[model samples]
Target: MLAPAQSAADSRSSVEQLVSRMSLEEKVGQLFVMRVYGHSATAPDKADVDANLREIGVRNAAELIRRYHVGGIIYFAWAHNTGNPQRITGLSRGIQRAGLAQPTPVPLLISTDQEHGAVARVGRPATLMPGAMALGAGGSRTDACEAARIAGEELAAMGINQNYAPVADVNVNPANPVIGVRSFGADPCAVAGLVVAQVKGYQSAGIAATVKHFPGHGDTESDSHHALPTIRHTREQWDELDAPPFRAAVAAGVDSIMTAHIVVPSLDPSEDPATLSRPIVTGVLREQLGYEGVVVTDALDMAGVRQKYGDDRVPVLALKAGCDQLLNPPNLDLAWSAVLTAVRSGELTEQRLDQSVMRILRLKAKLGLLRDPLAARREVLGTVGAEAHLLTADRIAGRTTTLLLNEGGLLPISRRSHPRVLVTGADPASPSGTTGPPTAALARAFAELGFKATALPTGIAPTAANVEEAVTAAAGMDVVVVATYNIAADGPQRILVSRMAATGVPVITVAIRNPYDIAQLSGFGIAASLAAYGWTDVELRAAVRVMAGRTEPVGRLPVPVPHAEDPARMLYPIGFGAMYRRSGV
Candidate 1:
């Protein structure tokens, strides 16, 4: 899968020798991963660093590298928000330069949550491809592989060597707050197929792919960002539903597996989340599944792990639990000092610390970061978000436009009739607080297709007054398209759409984020239902063409759409899609 680790014996020897020479502080630093900002050319000047200090939480990138010696640096939307390719490249280059400047000069693993689709952290300057669910809807392993390959290429071009992506979680729970659209789908076998392809694709391009939320974050309803979620399923049930994709990932030689914040009682009887549970992380993922690669913890700062374990204690617990990388610790100095102290005392042995440090160094060596950490700025600027990559994204989006329902054949609105289409929708705010377009971009694409389309942006959670206004406004429209962003979770948006459907006009519902929205809104008399899986410009445009009869609705539902009234009942099973036919009648 990955060419037998490529000179495995030599790499191990090098890492062993390097670890032998490192001090306890340096070796401890190799286990912690921290966040740093101000990578872009447009970043505030050094004198103005204090002005933005409260926002970025650090005066400069050098502070973390020089003081803590973090093994990796994670970039969020804030750090690379400027959609400027040159600036993003400069940010990555600068971070690498800082790492290289260390005395021993171990290269930092530059990573981001570039899961493409709705979860992209550095997407503005890179090709914004459809996410895992969208690719699953397309039902083409080839397209999924290509989308990941393109993402890997763009990320690698920008000097980012790791992507916390290809979410291996099988989203079986409709109420899952976090992994809905981020996951590939509901079926374990189907998710495994796509997961393996994505792993090959990313690693083939030289960017390490981290298959996430290991025992599975799919069946749980709670969001780990705020609280700890416990999966009560037995080991047998887990093996049946949750563990297949991860097992597939290991067989594919994935570069990394990100542990979930949720606790699995089946794996570990204790209440510790997988990130801190030695039985789950080391016993199950390593001994049982045989994953020899790196094991990274999901942001330790998240409330799931943070609330249970203090900031000072998480780093040591994570290392003792067999995690190679401690990602996004809340208190860097405290965590570093705790791990150092643990090693100094008998709490954590020196050999245990060396085990993780050696793994981190070996991974760096595998990624060729040890050989050449700096990227050529000229090459990055030229290739990041290149037109070729954008075209690939567009094609994948087109294939992923799923038509879940077409009752009474309401789609393919005729241009001859010059249908007055009223497009109304809400833009769900991202977890990172980023806002997207008010109206689904489909409205603009409708006008481009020669239909008289008007977009009315509604609040995410609309009031009764908002619903009344939208329903009254749709009275005279030939067809009303109600676009929903996570309407399954937002009660007001669902009410707004139901009201529009009650207007006795042809109401076509399009799920702009989660495909499960169609199942939730199926009780309403929707003339048509489509799942774009994401609200990207490419996805929106693709949805418009499918509705306009310009392109065929080829995408199938990746996850089963459960009935709104009864969660166990399926409104539409996975692999469901209606073919569009050209007709004004």
Candidate 2:
């Protein structure tokens, strides 16, 4: 076994040798991390292949590898890329074979957005750990590290070497549409601590950790997926609020840092987003903070980075801004040609391209992908969603259920007394576009605990008809448990909870996605409220156990809960969580 110092030296030397022998085309391709639609890698003719041909302008995964010479591939569940452990391993092996078959024979870096909680791309059969806010709520660096380590192990088991995770943003704005539960909390120091823990944990599993949305995406009200959002923090504020976690991550020797698409006027006065701002990317991240690792951009397809530039120009701008990887460009052909043209025209020097390519190659070499990037089917199947991993997820989830409001000591209701229960609420899909309705999961969990619990699914933005259906069903129930998902103060889901409260049955509300839902549920007079942070099955089951007094509610509010009416008043401060009295029956 090579010493860590010697292994790093050898990796750097090997990366330099490989870069010296690469063509401009291969070097430029090494800077891109594109997405392709498929389950199988080398399958030449299939529906999935046709989808890739239509979207990425490629026939299949093999064509993507052969034609683009892409340095990385990001797997998305919606792209039909990940199915199960065996399938993912097979795809990884096949894609690696395609890349190794090339004239230069460079291995591809396979990555995914497996941050767990609400933003996981690989689901089900893979271990689903708690999200960032959940870890923050639990407030234990040991738990945070363990969760990330388990996630890294599972991801690596299936041949994914990179994870765009451990969101370092301090979520100061409850109205942030994109990064609410994704962030650790509003406290910079606390967030920094957890981010460092997660980075160490992830890298310990031999997967490269990428701390993301640089400068910070937490305080913005808008989602960068649709429109551009500008952050107006002063240089002092940016240094205090948004820069600590990244600084800590760099200090921890993080492998990569992903740029946010939002514009920070303080970092760069120009209208360019961080992904396209040389001042922010090169000036702040590179020189000020001393992050020598690979710097990847958020998806080029996001409107946040494309507001001013066309598809072809976005990649060029990101590359020129010092980004080592251009992720998920909207049009691969246009972006590829634009970069090639820029280099050929002397607008982007080959030396510049070589710099980014060397960092990327060093990352691949560091992951041992330079030697072997394939996964054995038996090993992957044995490790991906092992029973021990599931238990770890369940234990972590158990630690994150926060009891915010128990007005009448209505929690831990004796299943003996509250024998008749109805589990009904908004079953909304998570921000990642995965996870089914959590109501059924909640109901099943209660049923297993010896209660006659029934579930009635209510859409996220419930209609009058949906409310009436749930209200009518709750008439005979002894207790009602409703889950809320980011409910606005005036949203129809509030009406659903109000009607449930009016039914004269004891009401227990679980905030499935956002903890702020409890503020909206105020004045409706619910009996108890808990913040589950996410709606995954593990989270729901853990909440049920907490409500049943099977486990203690140890999680605190990671983010502050503001008053629904005033918005300025603190309804519950950060780290506030009610505990059950030992004498409560």
Instruction: Compute each candidate's TM-score over C-alphas.
Output: 0.93, 0.97
lDDT of 1 at 296: 96
How many steric overlaps are in each model, in order? 1, 0
Worst lDDT run of 10 residues, candidate 2, spans 1-10
Indicate the TM-score of model 2.
0.97
For model 1, residues 1-585, the per-residue Cα lDDT tens digits are 123355888777777777787777888888877776565423546654663365335577766677778898887766532356666667777777777787777788888898877787875547788888988998789988988888888888877888898999999888898999898999999999999999999998898999999889998889999999999889899999999999999999999999999989889988898999999999999999998889999998899998787888887888889998999877777788898999889899998888788778878888888777774523776677788988888888889989988987777777665378998867665433223563646678888889888888786777788788888789789999888877644488888888898888888888888887776675688899889887777778888899888888999988988887787888889888888655573
Positional deviation of 503 in candidate 2, in angstroms?
0.8
Task: Give a tens-digit lDDT track for model 2, residues 479-582.
Answer: 99998989987789989999999999989999888799988876888999999998888888889999998999999998999998898999999989999987
> Which pairs of residues collide in model 1?
39-91
